[model samples]
Target chain A: MPREDQGPLLEFKAVNTYYGDLHVLKDVNYTIGRGEIVSLLGGNACGKSTTMKTIMGVVRPTRGSVTFDGQPIEKLATSERVKRGIAPVLEARRLFPRMTVYENLEMGAYTQKRGAQFDEDLERVYSLFPRVKERRNQVSGTLSGGEQQMVAIGRALMARPRLICMDEPSMGLSPLYVEQVFDIIQEINRQGTTIFMVEQNAAMALSIAHRAYVLQTGKVVLSGTAAELRENPAIKEAYLGELQVPAAA
Target chain B: MTAVDVYLQQAINGVSLGAMYALLALGFTLVYGILELINFAHFNVFMVGSFVGLGMLELLGVMPNDPALTGLTLVGVLLLTFAVTMVFSGALGVLIERVALRPLRNIRGPASMITTIGVSYVLFNIVLLGFGADAKNFPSPLPQVQFAIGGAVLRLREILIWVISIGLMGGLTYFVQFTKMGKAMRATAQDPDAARMMGVEVDRVIITAFFLGSALAGAGGLMFGLYYNITSYVIGFQAGLRAFTAAVLGGIGNVPGAMLGGIIIGLVEAFGSYWISAAWADVIIFSILVLVLVFKPAGLLGRIAPNKS
Candidate 1:
């Protein structure tokens, strides 16, 4: 994994956000480098999703700046941010319910305009989630939770984004699907696309993430390398509850 | 009138009336589908179209007695009314969007609904003050040609109603299915946030929806005036209510559904008036509404889904 000193891909400088004066995200400062899988770990209502949403321009920060590709994107609209290759798969896999799987994929490539490359993107999405191809004519609303997650991720990938933000991807998934989703995130990172993920499962998230940040009540309480966080006593007590030490052979 | 011939005549009249209702309902449904807001002021837009038709007829100097050039002049009046009403109603739709709907979109739903109702009342009173209480008779452009088909006599106005309504509906369907902008409108209707994220100018698409819907209502108004040969400020309320019911019956937001609902309601009214009793027309229509709601709450062609918790 690349060091944080190597210049980050996305930088949030003292960003603050609010939900109608509730002051949700407070002075959030974080960086995710290119080709890295960084996870934002926190319990519910800890501003983990808020951080991701702020970065995606869904929740505009009230103070400070967010820079993507070394340009300030704080004032840009969510769609403009998306066009700049920053895609987000929101929590709960909000797919267009009435649209067919193929149509849902086509909507993902909406920014690509009508061109030859649009077909190429569809092919790539189909290749990533072959089940989507099998059920191309099926409406997205009928898909299982795991399949919907796959469609959501695949849809984001179709945008040809340099960075993808995933919010609570493993919320209601079975353990096996959770592992599969994590593997896919790692594979996507291996393919050179950066990932900023918000996850409730701290152990699984830190296992794959190169770096991680722990948020509590709209503020970052902890930040370090994955190994350092895994070894931290406080993190173990707060997240893992009881540490499992391997027996001596 | 013979039993079979009267039945045929009523059916023809019902179908023609239903065609007009279908046109109006379609306009209402399109706007409702996209915006999820009831454009109550649309009724006045329709009435304004009739008034504009009256103005055009007067401009052409085709008095009620001048039967010499009346036929050609009536055609000019129809075209003129259609053009003027479309522009005027289109502008009114956009204005309402900008002034009332847009401002209140971010507000709560109830507030917006009440605001729209208020706007509707304001429009009604304004027209009443301008046009007064007397009903103005609209001069028909086409001669009242009636022909025998089987046992029933068909009126030219009735034929014109079908031709115009069906033609507009076909054109609209083609535009929505084939045009890029129409696709964008549908996309926006489905999911505004996602549509915006996909770089669709959501506001512009919304404005376009309003324009198209209002234009259709304007055309329907002109046709209604031509067929009924009467116009009044208060006429909009009855038409608007019936059209709203038609839209609801046709699945609220579905375009073709609105047309179907309109035609069904029209037939019900006509048949009820002819065979049952004219006084029971509304009761029959409302009964159908209750039946539709009880069985298919989503209306015809509406896809049912699990209710979101």
Candidate 2:
């Protein structure tokens, strides 16, 4: 559990979500501090994705409050939530397939007032994903998986979000691409953007996460600093499985 | 009739008819583009516009034989019908959305289609019951001025059809290409979920689309009444079906395609009816559709990639 004095940027107070009477997320609680990289680590069917969806307002919680920046966003519409600087890079890179990469980014800045600020935001997105700038006119659907993922992240960043909730950025990507994505995530966090990520790759996630929560069966089982969670025996046995050999040896 | 003169006359007539078809087809395409569901009740909205025009004429006490008041009365009736039909039909679109569509949100595609067809029949019967079965004659607003162009005759009605259709099309094109709201509509049509995430009120944008589309259909209906000088309960059904066919032929969800398809269909029908046989006009059009489908199913200007969910 995080200390009470840490002052969370986002706090979910016992969130309970249901999909037509089937309990999906049961009494889930967690917090991420401002400018922190926090990962919700879990295996499949463990409600990690559900937690992200709930925060993004894609799925509403039946019983709980999701407070972001001291404002409760539980009842706000998904679009309205987006306008308030809360953006989510959904799993599977949910891009507007027919639209070009640049158009997709412009869409992200849809909520922003139409002016010079919007143009500056587009430039920032292009700068962050230089590959996207190279292929600005390419249709998002035709792009490679890694490139598409970059477009998704770039699109979200166009909103100039206070917090970005990413759902499995490493999924379906090659190892090199995975590492690149992680580096970008770290770079973004270093630039003072708080990130809440849901990842099955616990080892990599824990390495960068300032704080982390291990979720099991719709509930949080453990919470601690990155180093503490890395050393935890339960995570090692279930997620890490085996250690790599030293290069010198 | 001399071959060249007959051809020229037919071409002029086809152009006028094409303009009206394009106007109506735009409504069909715009609605279908935004919402995947086909609004069968759109036809009834067109029929309602005719009724509104008739009501306006009656209120103004314009008679078919009264030449003095006919011109002024026509303008008044057209404006009154346009305003009333737009608002009323737009409300009908909203009502259909809320009552018919909202409840069936979870229902799959085929079922929604059948439900819309059922709604269309219900609207047809209601209009039939309200208005008598007889076809009512509408008084013409303009003096039937005819001009000879290259040995072919052209009427004032034909000229009005071209001017109105082109003017409206240009206005709509400008609106869609330049306006902020139009951009929002296009974005929503492309991706509803992404549009919502962009802070676009998807439902409101859809409502605006419906209002604009239905209003256009209403305008077409008033023009149809003026040109044909008759209105009937079942008139919208045939016209609606043709407009829908035009929409499909041009590419179901493409706005510009609808216009192109409508004009093509009009020209085909006119040429077929004049040269071959009136009985085979529809058959020829449908055959053309089959050929288009087999060769290029996406229609003339359709996007190559399928829309992402």
List CA RMSD, all candidates.
3.9, 3.8
Candidate 1 retains true contacts at a fraction of: 0.41
Q: DockQ of each candidate's interface versus the true one?
A: 0.39, 0.56
lDDT of 2 by residue, A1-249 (tens): 333444777999999999897898889888778889999998899898889878878789999999877778899988778887788887887887766787778777777777888888778877788999998999787999999999999988888898999999988999889888999999988988999999988887887899899989888999999889878889888886675212331
- For candidate 1, lDDT tens digit of each residue in B98-190? 998888787765777677778888877887898898998777667767898878988888887888788889988987755667766766767
> What are the per-residue Cα lDDT tens digits for candidate 1 across A1-249?
323335777999998999987988899898888888888988889888778778877678999899887778989987788888898786887777666777667767767777878888888777777887898889888999998888889888878898999988887998888888888888888888999999888888888999999999988889999999989988888876554222320
lDDT of 2 at B270: 86
Clash pairs detected, candidate 2: none
What are the models' TM-scores? 0.89, 0.88
Residues B157-188, candidate 2, lDDT per residue (tens digit)? 88877887888888888777556677677777
Model 2 residue B249 distance off true place after TM-score fit, in angstroms: 1.8
Shares of reference contacts reproduced by the candidates, in order, are 0.41, 0.72
